[model samples]
Target: MESTPKHQQLLHLLLLTTLIYLSSAISIQSSFPQEALPTKSGYLTINSTSGSSIFYTFYEAQNPRTPIYDTPIVIWLQGGPGCSSMLGNFYELGPFRVSFSLRHNVEHLTLVRNSGSWNRIFGVLFIDNPIGTGFSIAGSPDEVPRNQHDVAKHLFIAVREFIGLEKSFENRPIYATGESYAGKYVPAFGYYTLKKNARLAKSRRLNLAGVGIGNGLTDPEIQVGTHALNAYYSGLINGKQKMELEKLQEEAIRLTRNGNWSEATSARLRVLGTLSNMTGLATLYDFRRLKPYEDDLVGKFLSSVEIKRALKAKESISFEVCSDLVGNALNDDVMKSVRYMVEFLVKNTKVLLYQGQCDLRDGVVSAEVWMKKMKWEGIGKFLEAERNVWSVNDELAGYVQKWENLTHVVVMNAGHLVPTDQAVNSQAMIEDWVLEKGLFATGQVTQKPSHIGTCSIG
Candidate 1:
């Protein structure tokens, strides 16, 4: 019953939601039909004061008539704190959702036709964060901060540099979005940006709009508590251990009261392991990848000979290439990012939390509990909407909860990654919420429905 960040919990249903879009987009991008995406791929570096350089890849929307500055820019972050945004770019949302197909152009597709990609209206920037995941490398492992504030400071410096180099992006409304471990990363970064803005009001360089997180790892206390509780409810653990877990939770709470998180987490982890039935590695019983992927679909659409021909002809993107990485570094980075996010939340910044329904690591039960704890308040009132699909146990499982300038939501039929799990549905909800500010202004779901399909308890 270890709970994930509220954002991560709600995205468990995304696989089902995005299946249709993925099928169609794959067909078109593979040359089964003509497909187009809005993006001009490039890379940039942000040099940190600690002498570490953070690398990021930009995907600018490419429309013959539209200028780059005209498109809203979204900086995408993949969770794991150590995971690569490239995972989101290729496997999840970006312009072209990449599959493990050894195929050519078919491997990726445009965000618009994909129905789940943020590309149609957004200029996407995929960052390999914390200077370890993907291509980003740190000068020293020790340079990475254990506390969240330093992490935010370094990341802010990187983002600020990117903005300085790309002046056009300055004018465009900028938003940050991510999933998994990002629950903390997004909030921390957003807070840092707001702090920087306050300091540089005279310069007026930053044009940040908001922050978004999907299937995030939010507060460790609540999330971990949910993780243990859910496991018991889900029948992953039993009898004496369950009672022991409850007692441990009580102890943890008491420790937190006494400002002893180390003891609290230590006790919590021991109980969590029994509750989750961990097999050495930390993972939830539900929402783990249920099946392996089938064969690569690349050859079915495009021939290797054709790809070779295109390459010989000197084409821009004749072949598809997956991201390359070494080893162990990614895992290390994820751990570091997690610590940083926890520190970031104390700042005054806007945060948007989202997730799919099918995700177990981060799930709806946890989200409900999380909202209650956040002491949230909306800047504007919530709007009632038609055809809301968020529900569980005969209660509207979703809510448009807010705090200051932040908005947190749970999407239907999504999993660990909402954009990838339920691309179209998730995208529709996020786009409206973020770009149009619909969560604050229009088409917002106010009351939870009594049921979704048949999963309601009542």
Candidate 2:
């Protein structure tokens, strides 16, 4: 009951004022999101294998937005090993287009207005992964997946639970989409889901439709080869480096052809990173040449401090010490605990492989090489037609090459994150493919804008 010191009393008063201001600010901010959107978004939580809970921001399609649910439910997965789907959400293809500053207000783009957002005909899901990404948390380190198979299992289970509880997305077509290292992740997860679906088919719980891997890392050998070839052609290599890479490629191919995949794989993983100008665990798939702001609008979007803060705060538990952990082991020697997903492709799960011309990491070199080798018994010419309505050089830039149902596109001037770099093209490609129509089959696909306003070049 002693009288408070003047300074102490002043401090208390300041704290009280600050708290009130912050409370009102948060309330106002919260109301803004709900008020701005034509449709209201809710939240859903699911438990992972380790009992850690994962949170998802669910934007329920409104009556006007109702057609979206009937279309496709796209679950986007970004590939940082430590990256969040939010990267793809805001920077790439989410409903809300983030502002230039990472720490400022966002510019929300509606499907009706943009005609480019996937929300026009798909329910987009931006997930915070591994329990520590974004606001999501895991119960323990074990609850998180150190490998691809476990990640696929847990995520699918979570999605299943969410769908069940919502009861609105049960029969919706589900596709897995991601970029960069997701090259490894997307296929592995897709394979796991396909296998599990086969196992649980009679139970009728699984609703996986197909998979879309945009400039993904599905094959290790191809990834390294592409990196090396791209470096060599793009002048990232010099005399000795070029010589060594050529020799290494020959030797690796010899080993792979001779059934010595492990040795060849180890050699490639070791050399490709250096030759390709990559370093660290997830470096092989990063664009070493372009700094964030200088590249294009997409790069600027990806470079936002807001996304960086959110990603930097998340826990990254991926084992990317070697390429083998992320790519197909049969073609490489790097040993990762994750399972190879070529078997899944063999099982006829709809697989789409698209590439961006400027994605120096895992360029079309790899996808082209891999697809050529995919012995799909399905009927279709490798480069049959201009599947993408948005084609250049009669090449379709993107094409429906491999499987009858499976398709691939190489977006012109786009980078690794195709959707972000070329959202219109990417969306057009996806819409065409998903609807069972070729991207250019109609010969009436919308053309890319000649002028993109003040937006930076991507």
Candidate 3:
């Protein structure tokens, strides 16, 4: 049939528009040394309203039971109060791990496939948070966030931009997660995002489903007090040293009460330092590791010209595992408790706190100690909930205790870094929780209530 000239012109325009839209939907996935997940790395220019740039590496869920859109969105942040998310990207949970090697006259690192990468079930986004960390940079020192609240606000903008960049991610269930210092970052950001979503019209809001924290340092006052207990029980300190450690923690709490934030963190670290020295333990982060923490491998790998050009990493800034500049800027917020923010989410949504059982710092002891003092509606139920063995591949991997809207997981035989030590188990745990689609699947529902698991798990 013969069509009118104007009709034909309109048809051409429509086709052109559709082509442009499809192109924008999927970003370019670069080839890597270890070809595993369909991954893309880039920077989200904080949003014009809040002019900061954050670097991110996004990997779509590999081998998902449902479509990628149905799979949960997991944003991972590594903590040092200033650590690069790239540290998590290469060393912990991401698909490609840096293969470290030291040779005569030179040392080099390479990428290797991580079979237990979390990307197997959840779409993962690794972000360099709070600005001025890793490849993310600020034009001046004034641009960096000075407090936890500011850090959350900046991250909120960055995530919004990230979702906008890919239209397919607009409606997915979003989860904010981090380890270590992120204990403060996750709750603050989750609370802020949830509140903002409530205020905005439905069409203008971003969906924030829940939050997960691994070995977090959220409550300065309470967490500091656990050092003495963890040290004594782990056999890292004698009774005499523990007594002195308890005194130091008391001093830290007093400083925290008096609003001396920086001094509080300092006091707490000194207690751990003494324990570390006397016991000859290498690092408080991981009692299992014989050697000290080596972030130099990550720094060298990222700083390599070959890697930068291959990934099209455009950031002109140098990469560091932990940024001293960021740490110094945020010292004043070290003692601030994120309990209020976490409590807000606990009332409305779900919160997951997964800890390494043997970690001397930011482990089960600290989490349980501070959690008891929280004002969340779930506190009573969480406390009363029984621990149950969680199995992966038909073998017990961890213990889970949940109540109301909060779930706590303890990965046994694992130190500070759960993913690095018990990767497959941790990945299975995450997938089951997200797909099970329960706010808090307490063990009592699956089993009867008890103080601990009936069987030795993990």
Candidate 4:
């Protein structure tokens, strides 16, 4: 049978359309650092309705083992409910640290090699998550997430798009990691991925392997209750001050229980502020420091024209360390707990929760309080597991406890930002956990169960 001229023309058009779609899908920009490890930066459209997108920077491992595809990929999210993950990239664990200098009263910013970069063994992806935060763009104010569910959905979409676009990332084991408010973000994202994967074909599933959180606020109710005791025991507050803080804590809890979310968030802030005023502490994040850690230089550098071009960031969007708009939009979510997500993740994924000993905000005491209240089946074995001393280069670094798929570490002499305060130790800790070396390898109480039950908190 002879085909008509119109049929031939339609076939040609279909082929052309397919080619254009394929090219665009894989057309990621790789125009970043030539001297640094392989790096790529781009934006993934997350919400078509709002024209919202998430900006991300990915650095391939500097020294991956044989069969590089086996090397894990870690996606890092910074907490502010509004903070940029670039802070995690530049200040904590990226290929390079941003060094600031003043020459002749002029400020200069330069990148210096960090000996403790997490990317030394694992590919690291830093994301400016939640529309309106950092370089991530939201077409309208309405796009900013108001709760963890939306935050998780956006993150999941961004990651899925990224992996589908970048062929190298396909089939690679991925881990969700972050700190601070990311504690909630990390678990929420992990749980969302697992739930989504359950319904997808094996080849289409995201290979989400584990989750790691450092000094995170996963449970505000329990964590907020610890501030007073933490202050009083640390000698920062006396009995009278402790009681006052306790009263404020109770109010916050009551508001949260009554579902006065925004009011509860305000109450929580007041409690923190009162504790700060009474104790004369420079910052609640790290009690050892007389002044708060600053990231002003980071913002300045990221917002620079040269960096915008290098990172392929939009020149119109100036970088911010923390987005107030994003924070305000999530005010009501501040006191909400994502502990259930963490509980679900521990049952099906390897979970690493670490706290810096010196961190008063989400430190060991606060974490321990929440852990005791956790209803996981493995809680009994985890509590009985010995906390072995973790050391780096023959020096005591922290303590590690492992049971089933759950691992906890207490980093000594560190603050809220473990990677920044104790870079070397934190790097070692992540490496060991991901690679199953050292304490993580030797500290298992029982082989991870094939099936685990769900848990809830009151």
Worst 10 residues of 2 by lDDT: 27-36
- lDDT-wise, the better of 1 and 4 is 4
> Can you write out model 1's per-residue Cα lDDT over 1-458, one digit (the tens) per residue?
97688766557557656875666553334332224322333233444455456656566654422576766777887665465565676566765553444343345422234556776566777776766454555566765454456656767777777777666767776787877666766777777777678778645656777777777766655665666566567555676666777777777556655656556646655655655554232344234444422212332222344432321211222222222231232322322224233224323444566766656666666655554554323322322133344433333435455434445676654556666656666656566665545334433445444555544221
Better of 3 and 4 by lDDT: 4
Superior by TM-score: candidate 2 or candidate 3? 3
Q: For candidate 4, give the lDDT of residue 148.
A: 91
lDDT of 4 by residue, 1-458 (tens): 97679988999999999998765553211122456533888799987877899999999888997466788999999999899998998888888877776654455677777899999889999999888999999889988999999999999989989889767788889989999999989999999999999999997888999999999999998889999988898888999999999999999999999999999999999998998899787888888887898677678778777678777888889789999999999999999999999889988989999998888888999999898778799998999887777778977787888988899999988889888888999999999999888788744644333333232211
* Candidate 2 local distance difference test against the native: 0.55
Clashing pairs in 3: none
Candidate 2 vs candidate 4, lDDT winner = 4
Top of the candidates by lDDT: 4
Please give the distance, in angstroms, between residue 346's alpha carbon in candidate 3 and its true position after superposition.
1.0
Which segments of model 1 are wrong by more than 4 Å?
1-51, 62-70, 101-114, 201-204, 234-241, 247-272, 278-350, 375-406, 437-458
Q: Rank order by lDDT, top first? A: 4, 3, 2, 1
Task: Score candidate 3 by lDDT.
Answer: 0.79
* Reference-based TM-score, model 2: 0.67
lDDT of each: 0.55, 0.55, 0.79, 0.86
Candidate 2 on 340-387: residue-level lDDT in tens?
474356356566678876665567776676666665544235344334
